[model samples]
Target: MENNQPIISVDHVSMRFNLSKEKHESLKEYFLALAKGRLQFDEFYALRDVSLKVMPGDFYGLIGLNGSGKSTLLKVISGVYKPSSGTCRVGGTIAPLIELGAGFDMDLTARENIYLNGTVLGFTPKYIDSKFEEIVEFSELRDFLDVPLKNYSSGMVARIAFAIATITKPDILIADEILSVGDFLFQQKCEARMQRLMSGGTTVLLVSHSIEQIERMCNKVAWIEKGRVKMDGPAAEVCAAYKQTTK
Candidate 1:
């Protein structure tokens, strides 16, 4: 299922956030700070000038410490956030499982939430209708589908979200630390589902701190630190280098 085609190309992309220290202060004070050339503002560069490529069917791993910009990179690729500089070209359909239940309505029933989530992912009502039963079955929430989402446990919500995400059969899938959800048995099922997607030619970008999971799941890895890529190559080698540095 490995296509020898490039699916994503990121060229010298950088993302920055400008932190204004005088948001609550008066305009005169802010102008005075600027006039004095001592403005108390900071620039937080979440992702420095970084470039990378992902090919179709590639299981790409993004390994980094918290605040190292791994999640930022994923968000950029998924079009949730735009880069401040440089260009990112993504081919094919993309599905991001970044924050589970991000768009769910707490007051809506599970079934209603499914439709809402599916619509956000670009599925038509007919398409959602076709996959409704399958999604509920996969999540093992058939009985709870009629219950309000507010009544569901966090684990239950995550399960439904995961099921809805994978049902789209997207060409590009970006998952950020989603594997930490659910019980042990459910985690196994999710892993199996991911394997199925990979084998079916879906390009996956996985961001995780778990070295073992990265080694087991990804064919290529990129290690990031302080918003920069420290190492990029075969999964085992990159992971090894990361471990040595962290230790």
Candidate 2:
């Protein structure tokens, strides 16, 4: 039974990006246009007056058509993007698997980047050392440990990234289409790991296009359409309504 307490709160959040209308061929030309005050920008709002709450231990899903601000909302919640208006707050540490290899150094060896990324996520050196082997094993890249990450395949990169992010339990887990990049088997493995984390009271916020997956894994769903929430409630109801519109 979830109380009224919210672990993740997004209140009237709005995100805006300024896009330049003209692209200058060189830096010199760009500066000249800027000096003349001739550059023009179009303001685009990715999210508009969006609000949401996830209580402790809730399995939340975000579903929408592409460019419907699903990923933008997740980025805002993860602190990667500051909301143009309103606010987003999280109660605890977050493990965000939003973009593949976003925290990794491509030029560095997998082993080196593991420690680097782990530390960035707030794990102490001693804690990372304890989970070092487990990370390598889960990614199944034992022989490639010393190899530079740039040489790794996309799937290989996804493996290492997912492995490192889930190595230690987190208070909140945010994933954005991360499972789509991996093979089916690896996706299944990820789902199993997420289940275990949820059982331990880790709140999950997931973005996936698969309605079937959402209904199966999430207790609640929010349908975002054209930068606003069109529906929010029990997963079955929201997902069923969303599916109807798409059909």
Candidate 3:
């Protein structure tokens, strides 16, 4: 499928952030300074001329050290952020588990949030309704369905998030270390679900610190370094090269 049309085309994309040079203690102070022209910003490029192609059914892995802009690139591909330059074109439906509680209402009950989050992930109300019981069963939150999300543990939130995101077979699944918060058993469940997704021809864009997982799951790997793609190639080749950096 490498020779086929790309499922995801990221062409020379760049994401820029303007860092406020001055820190204000409160929103009032920040807004006051902004209105008076007393604030300054420094330009930062989270992604600089980064380009890559993810073909249909490709299980792509992104690896990097902390603060290397891996998440930013995911956000760009997820359409949470518009690139400052260039473009990212994604084909088909996307289920993004990039940020837990992203589309969730903390004050809402887990039962309510399932419909809420599912809609945000692009599921139609009727579709979500049909899959409601299945999602709840997978999440193992049938008992906690009425609990407010804010009161749930991180692991609990992760369970619901993963279950909802994977409720339907999305064309692409974007995950960012969400499994790391889950217990070992739950992580295994998430991995199993991902494996099923792969079997169904779903393209997956995953960011994880676990090189072994990447090596096991990804046919292709992209090593991001300081907002740029340092290496992009076969999983074995790029993982071996990336491993040398840790040594």
Candidate 4:
């Protein structure tokens, strides 16, 4: 697939965060606390020297343990966060399903949120209008579409958000642990829809801890550890390597 031409290119990307301790001294007590040494802020690197290329129609899996910067990398790719150093270029329109209901307004009705979410995913109102029925059916939220999102359960919100985010087929689809939501049946449905998208030539970048899901869905894999790529190769091979290291 390396010869297929890259749809996404991440070059030596690094993300850093500054952590500072808050002061808790009153004005009257400031003089007594002023003798404290200068506050030292620790710099945390979420992702360091990360680089990869994703080709069109490739189902790329990013696997890592908690705090391995998998989510940070996804955010950088989705433009939610900028890298401290390095370059990232995406060739086509991107739809990011990083967090369920992340961008939804709890006070808005599900119907309204559909348009809002769809717009954020770069879908025109007309496009959302055309796919409205399909999205509702997929989410099984037709009866609750007019109700405020706050009244819906978390799973319901996830379903609705997933449906809305996927209504418009994007050139690049980025998913971060979205499979952990909903019931077993809904998970099956979501997986089927994802298969359809991949078969239709959409590039997919999936971040998940589920090795089974990665093995079943992805052709290539990148194992990330401590904010760096530990290994990148065929899905089965990389997954095997990850399992060995973790165990």
TM-score of each: 0.92, 0.94, 0.92, 0.92
Q: Write the per-residue lDDT of candidate 3 for residues 1-247, one digit (tens) a residue.
A: 4439999999999999988777787999899998999887789999999999999989999999999999999999989999999999998889999978789999999989999998888789999999999998988888888999999999999999999999899999999999889999999989999999999989999999999989998999999999999999999999999999899
Per residue, candidate 1 scores C-alpha lDDT tens digits across 126-156 of 9999998889899999888789999998889
Model 2 residue runs over 4 Å out of place are: 1-3, 23-31, 34-37
Off by over 4 Å in 3: 1-3, 23-40
Across 135-199, the per-residue lDDT of candidate 2 in tens digits comes to 98899999999999999999999999999999888989999998888999999999999999999
**RMSD to the hidden true structure, all candidates:** 2.5, 1.9, 2.4, 2.9
Model 3: lDDT of residue 220: 98
Once fitted onto the true fold, the runs of candidate 4 whose alpha carbons sit more than 4 angstroms away are 1-3, 23-39
| Candidate 4 lDDT over residue span 1-247, tens digit each | 5447789999999999876454535764454445575455578999999999998989999999999999999999989898999999888888899888877889999999999888877788998899999999999988888999999998899898788877767888899888787899998999899999888888899988789999999999999999999999899999999999889
Give each model's whole-structure lDDT: 0.90, 0.93, 0.93, 0.88
Clashing pairs in 2: none
Using TM-score as the measure, name the better of candidate 2 and candidate 4.
2
Error at 189, model 3, angstroms: 1.0
Work out how many backbone clashes candidate 2 has: 0
lDDT of 1 at 81: 87
Deviation (Å) of 112 in candidate 2: 0.9
